[model samples]
Target: MILCVRFLLDARGEALLPDLLGLLGELTPVVEAAPPDTALADVRGALRYFGRDAEQLAALVRVRALALHGVDCVIGAGPNPMLARMAAREAEPGVTRVVPGSADGIREFLDRKPVVALEGVGRSMARTLCTYGLDSVDRVAAAPLGTLQRILGAKAGREVYDKARGVDRGTVVRNAAARSIAAERPFSRDELDPSRHRRALLSLTEELGVRMRGSGQVCRSLALTVRYADRTGHTTLTRSRTLREPTAHSASLTEVAYAMYEALGLQRARVRAFALRAEGLGPAEQAARQLTFDPADDKARRLEAAADKARARFGERVVVPGALAA
Candidate 1:
């Protein structure tokens, strides 16, 4: 069986994930890193050596993580990765949630959830599904796969169909190297101003973009994490968007970052911290750059190159965006 553990880590606590991952490694060799605080482990082989069932083993791992690194986590175990992830999402933090290996049990567990709660279903897809009255997992499962295909594309239709049925073939892939860059800014006090939030996000994207470009890497996805006030129980909201293509440009990163921020519509949220991550990284040389005819776009690229040159020679702060210049 596979187990997915979602770690509850604060902004300062993120540094402990690597230590926690190492602690998990003591239990099984199949620990797969899920970035921004999560991991998947295949414990089938360790069951005999540990002399425990999946739930019990998950408890032991959870205790070890807490005892060793003061990291409390929620663990969900199931027959497959999708079920495991969904189980974790359903459970409360700092607990072990298990989905039975039986088909009937899986269906019961998944059937009542809102379609939006499903792992792969986004806002747009959920709205589309709801329009057809497939607003719940059971409804989605009952619909013919062809209907989903007509609404979505063939690949997405097949994927969601299998997910609705709690069938996933994915496994814990071990020894994968992280290929993303991240930056975080914690406010001295909880911030409510939307302008400040935008500035922070822009700064983070600019910082991450510079690092990616410096390393000759391009990212195909952007992730935003908003940490709320401690008074609200240290809640953190995270979202990710896949770009149209890989890019190491600040403009591309800024556009996607702003889009995600605006979607949150947090007019007066008492946000304590902001984090931005660039993901799905590849060599810059490997990414195909599309030709642009707009003079403004051409001018921006040229200025970006010059700014990089200035930063390389003078310092990172040599070419700051006007919004960031106090």
Candidate 2:
């Protein structure tokens, strides 16, 4: 069984993600880290060792996280990664939501869900699907494959059709996300200005790019965590995305971080801090670069290299982007 765990951590507490991954490691070796506050654990093997089912193990893991780190988490249990991830979103903090590992059970759980609730269904596609009356998972699943393909290209349609039916073939990849570098920017005070938040994100990506380039590494994914300024209780929203390819480019990193921040949909919420993590590091020499035809894209890469050298000789402040300049 797959257990998707999302740690409810504040910006400052994102540094604890690795330790939380370790806590899961004690239960199973197939724990996949999806930082800045999530992980997937294939606990099928650990069930017999611990003498508990997936749901029981999830509860134990939650209690252990709170007892050991004072971190509350929600867990989603399913037969595969996709189902588990979807289940996690439906779960509240400090609880476990399960998608039963049976064909009938999976269908019953997913059928009534909104089509937009499926991961990777963009806003545009959701509208398009809804136009055709495929507003729910069951409706999408019931639609003919050829019809969906005509609406949303062949590849995406096939993928969506399979997902709506709770058919996920992905496995828990045992890559070490512990080999990551993180950068955090805390507001001098809780700030509400969107422009300032973006500036901080840009500054952070700049730092991450310089650090990764200096270390001769490239990251395959990035994570962004936002902390709210509520003193009574710390509230954090985190989201991570895998890049199409490995890169240490500052602009690319900045773009992904901005998208993540926007996706959180926190309009005018009191923001206290932001945390970014670059994960799945590999030697820069081993990474492939996608060729681009645009001169601007080429120039940006050239300028990035030059900026890295300037920062190495001078200082980070010496090579700040125009947007980051006060």
Candidate 3:
């Protein structure tokens, strides 16, 4: 049986994924990494080899992760990846939930969940469905696929319809390379200055660039999220027209990061914290850097390289950007 084991590790440190994967490797060879602390393992072969049923095998995996790795996990076992992921999300940490691979079992599990709980339905889609008086997954499953497609757009609508019916065709692909560098800062006290907020964002982007360069990844998309004092958050996404070349140049990440923030127009907004996530990452070799006759770009790249070297030799905060210091 296919199983999607989700580990909601302690968010304090980055040791979660490594430890979880090491523990899972003890149980099976067919393990796939899910980002931000989650994993999927195919235990069908291991189940028979170890003489344990699906549920029993799931329990063992959870126990091992906790006992050996000091990490808490939520295990979801099913016949397919989609069902397993959903089941795991619904389960509490340190428990194993098994969705029997049967029609009755699927129906029983999905019948009462909100339509939005299905994988493809986002908040907007869920709101739209609720407005149309279909608030539950069961109701969505009973709706015609054509109707769902028309309402949610052809692709999203079709995907949601399939998910509502517990139909997922995705296979767990293992060892996917890391594709982004993200950093989030929570303020000790919520502040109202847009300039200070911008400074914090700049600092985070610089940190991200440093880490990205160290790991040999370059990003193509910039995503910014601002958490307000009211606890509501907004996210803005923008992509670079040309692929950013694979140097961990802070200037490059900072330019795109600041541009995305400026586009948000958060004038004098009271923000509690800010996050910058650089997505669509690839190896530096894979990115095509534009050959620029612009001297400033070349100079900035050189300065960034020097700063990175200084930080590596000394420590973080050795080379703080002027704006961030303010």
Winner by TM-score: 1
Model 3 TM-score (2 dp):
0.71
Question: Candidate 3 residues 114-179, lDDT tens each?
Answer: 887888678987999998888999999899989988888899888888888788988766666766
Order the numbered candidates by TM-score, best leading: 1, 2, 3
How does each model score on lDDT?
Answer: 0.87, 0.89, 0.76
TM-score of each candidate? 0.76, 0.72, 0.71
Question: What's the residue-level lDDT of 1 in candidate 2?
Answer: 87
TM-score attained by model 1:
0.76
Per-residue lDDT, model 1, residue 277, is 89
Model 3 CA lDDT for position 232: 45
In the range 13-103, model 1's lDDT, one tens digit per residue, is 5577788888778889998887768888888888888888998888887888778777788889999888898888877766678899899
Model 2, CA-based lDDT: 0.89
Residue 175 of model 3: what lDDT? 66
Arrange candidates, best lDDT first: 2, 1, 3
Worst 10-residue lDDT window for candidate 2 reads: 173-182
Model 3 is weakest, by summed lDDT over 10 consecutive residues, at 234-243
Off by over 4 Å in 1: 131-133, 143-153, 190-203, 214-216, 225-245, 251-271, 280-283, 292-326
